[model samples]
Target: MAFEYAPAPESRSVVDIRESYGLFIDGEFADGAGGRIKTVNPATEEVLSEVVEADAADVDRAVAAARRAYDRVWGPMPGRERAKYLYRIARIVQERARELAVLESIDNGKPIRESRDVDVPLVAAHFFYYAGWADKLGYAGFGPDPKPVGVAGQVIPWNFPLLMLAWKIAPALACGNTVVLKPAETTPLTALAFAEICQQAELPAGVVNIVTGAGETGRLLVEHPGVDKVAFTGSTEVGKQIARSVAGTRKRVTLELGGKAANIVFDDAPIDQAVEGIVNGIFFNQGHVCCAGSRLLVQESIADDLLAALKRRMSLLRVGDPLDKNTDVGAINSAAQLERVRQLSELGTSEGAERWSAPCELPERGFWFAPTIFTGVSQAHRIAREEIFGPVLSVLTFRTPAEAVEKANNTPYGLSAGIWTEKGSRILAIADKLRAGVVWANTFNKFDPASPFGGYKESGYGREGGRHGLEAYLAK
Candidate 1:
């Protein structure tokens, strides 16, 4: 018999969700010309709040405000002076960490533990890390007195709302560039909360602005003439569209797109440790992560043992409410995303792969998916080739290390990959042969603000974290 866990729901009273919100332009909340869209809590399908859907005019206003800030205040500000504001913002983020975490869980449908421990902390860390870089750009190997790239237009996805905002806005502001950011339509609450934090920090008006909306709003922002830089984190298809739109423009663009990462396990790998890594890889944040290790490649000799252990571990994963502290898998972000996960999963089954899902009763109301793994999956299968963006893992067997590398590199995505082995030599050797931008040995989904993170090929280009992140906002 499995051990049962009692309900331990995190209190939502910490966050004060307004009934409606407006666009944050020039550091003030103003009415948007575009209509409003209601944001719902996926965990309960309850309407959380309605936020403004920024129109082209709103995008234009935001970009112009950022431009004005850049040219008048932020751009001419000394790097040391700019560092102070960044540090203040970081401190404010730390001060209100719990409220931000609870808001994130409520809006994003991720477990409260993840929002509290991983997302919010990392969001603060990125600001702090980049704050240190603000005054020390000369020592960063980017030449003496590197200049700002002017107004930056940033569009963040819903998976990790505040973290993605921090990733885009922190470095841009630290580098003395003003930013007009668009948080995803579904999860704009945290981004709006971040705007309030900016006010608390007394960040200069127009230095950082947030305009929330859907795809059309994003398009307008990205294509705006006032913005000198464009940073987007989303699907590969949208990334490509942005690339095409900016092809003839002078805008400096960086895109962190989709992935179909592979997690390779050697025969000599620690089964228990590998199982944990595998779980963290694909199921973390309900596998909404772009760089999630969706493919599991195990050495044929120990495939059975690994699969047995992995299934047992999967069975133990609790799935349900995002506010639950014991929940391993939370609700999917939206109804459309849940439908996408379902369609891909059904395709995985129809393509002749054996499907096995964890034994858990999902909530009747919310958009939820249990942890799942597919055995007998081939490289040719749709589940193996395409990005599912869900808590579905496809398992494949490889006879040797060379075959593993080949199978892993076969995907167009080059975001991230994992190698599990006790031997350091094999780990290094396989890592060298892998095509991924990030290769982890015996671990998965680990992130740090001090380290650079990005991808190659169809997965997208440029770095987001660390010293490399500043380059995107700096004039070359």
Candidate 2:
């Protein structure tokens, strides 16, 4: 007889969600000139809170505040002093990790285990990592006197909300620049909680400012004349718009955009391990990852066996409440995202691909998607070429390593890819030939604070997460 598991839902009482949230400008919560946006929980479709939608005027105010902070406080502050503030923030993140994790799971619809174990811990690690580099940047080979780029305008996506914020903000601050960031409208709660963290750290006013809103507010924030640097993480279409908007200007920009990464498995690869990596690659965070391995390329010899194993594993995935500790997949981030996933999946079937999904019951009220995969997928198919950004995998068969490389690089994106084999020489050789910014061998979606990450081609430019990341926020 199989073991039946009881409910082990994480308590929501750890977090205190506010009824309404305001913009975080100049180190305090303030009313925005624009209207309000209600953020809902994707798991239950429950209205979490209404946040002020910052406007062009709010952007102007935030930039002014950031400029003042740059000129008078943060920029002139010594590196050692800045390190102290960053370290303090890191400690505070660790102290309140549980609260932050619960809040993230509530607002973002990621599994509680992921929010607590992966997301929140990485947030603290980033602060600590950048803090160490704060006083030692001269040793980083950026020269004896690397200077700040004044005010930075950063915009983060709903996926990995706080971690994305850390990716953009940590290194910028370590280099002594002030920032004004805007979080995605649907998942602004955690960023606001981070704002309170900033206050708790007693960070100087305007050192870090968070403005909550949708696309329009982000447009205003990034295009403001006062910003010296702009960083964005979202879709490729919007990234191109920002690039065009910043053209012929003095402002520097770094875009971490969309991806349709490939996970290549050779005949000699460990079948069981590759299956697990495949699951983690596409289904982690319900496939919202920019570098998610949505394209699975399996050698023709092992393709059938791999597919069988993958299907069996997918059948075991638990798709339900975000707060459920045993859940493997959680809700889609929003209604629009859910629709996109559905439309693309429908297109996959209509385009002559065979579709299969995990047998799991999803909550009727919330935004949810079962883990799915499509076989007989061709490189010419829209599902193989475009970024689905959902828990949908498109499997393609390759006969040789060269063909695998060709098929993997066929997409316009080159953010990340994975290679699975036991041979070290093959791993090195294949990784060298791949066009992605990061390649994982025998594993996927592994990250570290010391390792730099980004993308190539339309996946966007510039690096984040390490010493290389600091250069984007520093002046030459």
Listed in order, each prediction's TM-score against the native is 0.99, 0.99
- Considering summed lDDT, which 10 consecutive residues are worst modelled in model 1? 137-146
Note the residue pairs that clash in candidate 1. none
lDDT of 1: 0.94
lDDT of 1 by residue, 378-420 (tens): 9999999999999999999999788999999999999999999
The TM-score that candidate 1 achieves is: 0.99
The clash number for model 1 is 0
Off by over 4 Å in 2: none
* lDDT (10s digit) by residue, model 2, range 375-402: 9999999999999999999999999899
Please give the CA lDDT of all the candidate structures. 0.94, 0.94
Q: Could you say which candidate leads in lDDT?
A: 2
